[model samples]
Target chain A: GAGVSQSPSNKVTEKGKDVELRCDPISGHTALYWYRQSLGQGLEFLIYFQGNSAPDKSGLPSDRFSAERTGGSVSTLTIQRTQQEDSAVYLCASSPAGDTEAFFGQGTRLTVV
Target chain B: AQSVTQPDIHITVSEGASLELRCNYSYGATPYLFWYVQSPGQGLQLLLKYFSGDTLVQGIKGFEAEFKRSQSSFNLRKPSVHWSDAAEYFCAVERGATLGRLYFGRGTQLTVWP
Candidate 1:
């Protein structure tokens, strides 16, 4: 892809239900990142992957939230037993190897009702 | 811990007026700084970035930012504003040694009055 791509532009799930958001990073980019943006809040870092291995998962809000990336191409973020507070836009980004500017995707707007 | 601070939550400026957005960061060492703009119903777009070399960096959409190490500030500025420039602006920082983790500040909403 020319840039990072996120699927299911919007998702509305009932409270306590599970939801999955997907992100497809740019080709050959070695680093991928996930972030959550709540209303009137800054981007909260969630996790980061380097070549299919997650070196940083420090920002996952709870055990219910987990993510995985396979083949260093596509990633999935699963939120189990969603809560109202989990409603936010989930963003994904990818960058080249080493220190570089990341290109972002059109985020998935998740609404936990 | 690394963090970015954007003091102004909202700002209003008349079209054609000059504009400036302030940002500050706290990091152990010299950090990578960036400015991003998010328009309504759109994804974030990179405005500018600074890693090293010149303190001043230019970006797309006629945006520019200056990095000041003394104050740990990277402020975005434009000589003239446009109505289309109305959007939310965010400041972000990355730890040079750490690589991929990027920290962001609370955004600043800019309202351009015509």
Candidate 2:
């Protein structure tokens, strides 16, 4: 794709239900990142991936939050148990390398009801 | 610890007026600075970035920002504001050693009134 792509632009789920958000990064990009944007909280770094491996998961909010990337192309973020506080916009970005400027996606807005 | 700070939560300006958005960051060394704009129901767009070289950097949509090392600030400025420029602006910083991790400040929402 010409730019980073995220699936299911918006999702509304009941509390305690699990949800999966997908991200497709730009082709040939070696670095991928996930961020969460909430009202007043600003953009929070969630994870960073180099190739197919996630080198930095320090930003994951909890154990329920897990992400994986395969073939260095597509990635998935799964929230095991959703909570009301989990409602936010999830953003994905890709860069040619770790230190370079990243291109961002439209993001998936997750709403936990 | 590295962090970005945007003190103004909301700002309003009349159309065609000059605008300035303040940002400050805390980092041990000089870091990569960036300004991004997010319109309602739209994704974030890069406004400008300061890596090295000249402190003043020009960005899209007639926006410019100056990077000051002493103050640890990167402020965005525009000579003339437009109605369409009303949006949420964010300031972000990346560490020199850290890769792919961008620390962002609480956004500043700008409202342009005619």
Candidate 3:
């Protein structure tokens, strides 16, 4: 079966710019999550979506970050006026339900110069 | 808040040698523990997880982890090492009530030398 996939394996952008990262979860998966991994830091949760309800945005660092999922299959994360601090590997994952293990995508390495 | 700790930032082992990666966690209740491996240019892949019941759980790629409730530890181990196993290993602990958020450790980088 096809696993989760993310586009633009590597991305470079100037500071104050905007960027969008896309993810395609496994078929039939109902739970989606986004995380950020910095240089020497642990994976930081950004947002989560389950069954089309309001997504959990508490983990999102600031208003600059937002994500959307359409038809319960694909997701896109948008960063507005990105900063150098936003430079990191953005990872996406999906699970069958709340308690199951989540599978991850290869990630989009975002670099803000 | 729930948190995870991987005391050793890096570990080096020779091929065919035994391997152990330590993980410690802090949570209010019984925690859901997991080990994941991230190869270069790839996403994290689940190695194993511990929910309830058996203290020892087996996972993909010939890996296993043991949860020691008394010590707040869930260490991952393999009887022998392979060069392919060289990667970043992260320990994660999910609080029972948190639902979807997984708190991850800083990670341990394994170097397998032949």
Candidate 4:
């Protein structure tokens, strides 16, 4: 409500299991983004949503990674057959407009065991 | 495609010392630049942003960044460093206004020694 919110601050899953990470952007925000940060790495752009439609999904690592947004408010990232390398912090951010500063959430730490 | 480069992977500075973190970007047009800080176990917070204007932008935590179009750089600076300023810093560039795709650098870890 106040800022971007992400669920499951920490997640542990089996190597082949699938997992879903959720992101709730700030109220009235029109743009949302998802990013992945591996240990010792920078933020990797995963996707961007402009009013519940993803205009750019080029950053998604593989076909197994899919994401969707509904009602322009909440988004979910799904990973099928997770791998150990998938372990990282999944961050969500939302901006009032397309080209403005974005507020971020604490992120979901996913650890694929 | 756009990309960001941060030269220093890690840096150490004593408390009260001046600090500068270098960042460079490659984009087709005038890009939207930003600097973000991530403290340990915390989310990333915006330090400053540059879209257009004086080329100099001020941000919270007593930090400032200068955008040099000629050099394709947006370097972040602080007059004096504090121990609490120790964190990981990232530089990013918006590829285009329509796409809203952001390319981020590999980040620089700042360690302030007392």
Candidate 5:
């Protein structure tokens, strides 16, 4: 079976620029999650979608960060006006169901200068 | 509020020796506990999870975890650790029935010596 895949393995951008990261979840998965991992820090929850419905967005650090999952398969996380503080590895994961074991993607390393 | 705690930020263990990684969690109600391992430049891999029933659960890579409700702990253990086991381990807790949003700990960086 195909695992979760993420695009733009590495991205370097200037501050105040906008960047979009893509995630393709496993086939038939109904749950998708996005998290940020800063160096020497734990995984910080960003947004999660269960069948295209995001019931939890509280983990999103600010309004500049937003994510959406459409057709219950793919998800996109967009950062508007990125800041140096936003530089980190963005990871995506998906599970068969909302509360089951999750499979992860390699992650996109976003660097803001 | 729900939270996960990994007491040791780093631990060094000798190869073929016993190992244990402590995890404590704070949750209002019954909690879902999980342990994940991440190698450098890789995503997190689920080591094990404890939802309900048996307090002891087995996981991949010869790992196991015991859930102690009284102490609010779910500790991971591996009797004989291998050098390849060196990596960052994260302890997570979830609010029951809420997709277990997974509150992660700061993580424990394990170092294996030969």
Candidate 6:
């Protein structure tokens, strides 16, 4: 892909339903990151995957939220039993091996009703 | 714990006026600094970054930022503001020792008045 690609530009679901967000990073990029952006708020880091191992999962908001990356190319972020607070734009970014600047995707706007 | 702070919530400036947005970060050691801009309903785009070099760094869209270690600040500046520059600006920092985790500030909204 020319740049990072995210699926489901917008998602609306019931409060208790689960949702899966996908991200296809730029080819050969070694670092992928997930972030959440609430209304009028800055991005909050969720998880970072370097290769297959996520050395830093400290940013995950809760146990209900989990993410995994396979083949170091695509990543999926799953939110189990979504809540109103989970209604936000889920963003994904990827950077080259050196980790200088990151390229971001359009993001999935999640709405919990 | 590493965090970024952007004190001003909203700022309004006339077009062609000078603009400056402040950012502060807390980290044990010198960290990688970055500035990103987000337009309404758009994804974030990198403006500039500072790892280790001259304190001042230039970025796309005529944006620039300076990393100040003593005051723990990395402020974005534009010589002359434009109406199109109206957007939300964010400050981010990566703890150097740590690999890919980036801490971001609350953000500042810039409003340009014509």
DockQ of each two-chain model: 0.75, 0.72, 0.75, 0.66, 0.63, 0.69
Assess the local accuracy of residue A49 in candidate 1 as a C-alpha lDDT between 0 and 100: 92
lDDT of 2 by residue, B1-114 (tens): 778999999999999999999999998898999999999877778899989999999999999999999999999999999999999999999885557578999999999999
DockQ order of candidates, best first? 3, 1, 2, 6, 4, 5
Superposition error at B42 for model 5 (Å): 0.3
Residue A2 accuracy (lDDT) in model 3: 95
Place model 3 in a CAPRI quality band: medium
Ten-residue segment with the worst summed lDDT in candidate 6 chain B?
A: B94-103
Show the lowest summed lDDT stretch of 10 residues, model 5 chain B: B94-103
User: Which 10 residues in a row give candidate 2 chain B its minimum summed lDDT?
Assistant: B93-102
- What's candidate 1's DockQ score? 0.75
Q: Across residues A1-113, which tens digit of lDDT does each residue of candidate 5 receive?
A: 38999998999999999999999999998888899999766688888789999988888999999999899998999999999999999999998874567788989999999
Instruction: Mark the 10 consecutive residues where model 3 chain B has the least summed lDDT.
Output: B93-102
Supply candidate 1's per-residue lDDT for A85.
Answer: 93
Q: After superposition, how far is residue A91 of candidate 4 from its true place, in Å?
A: 0.6
lDDT of 1 by residue, A2-103 (tens): 888999999999999999999999999989999999975669989999999998899999999999999988999999999999999999999899856888
Q: What is candidate 3's lDDT per residue for A37-87, written digit by digit as tens?
A: 998666998888886653577888999999999898888999999999999
Worst 10 residues of 6 chain A by lDDT: A39-48
- After the best TM-score superposition of candidate 5, give how far the Cα of residue A93 lies from its true spot, in angstroms: 0.9
User: CA lDDT, every prediction?
Assistant: 0.92, 0.92, 0.90, 0.91, 0.90, 0.91
lDDT of 2 at B81: 100
How many residue pairs clash in model 3?
Answer: 0
In angstroms, the error of model 4 at B78 is 0.3
What tens-digit string does per-residue lDDT give for candidate 6 at B1-114?
667899999999999999999999987788999899999888889999898889999999999998889999999999999999999999898885556567889889999999
Residue B69 lDDT (model 5): 83
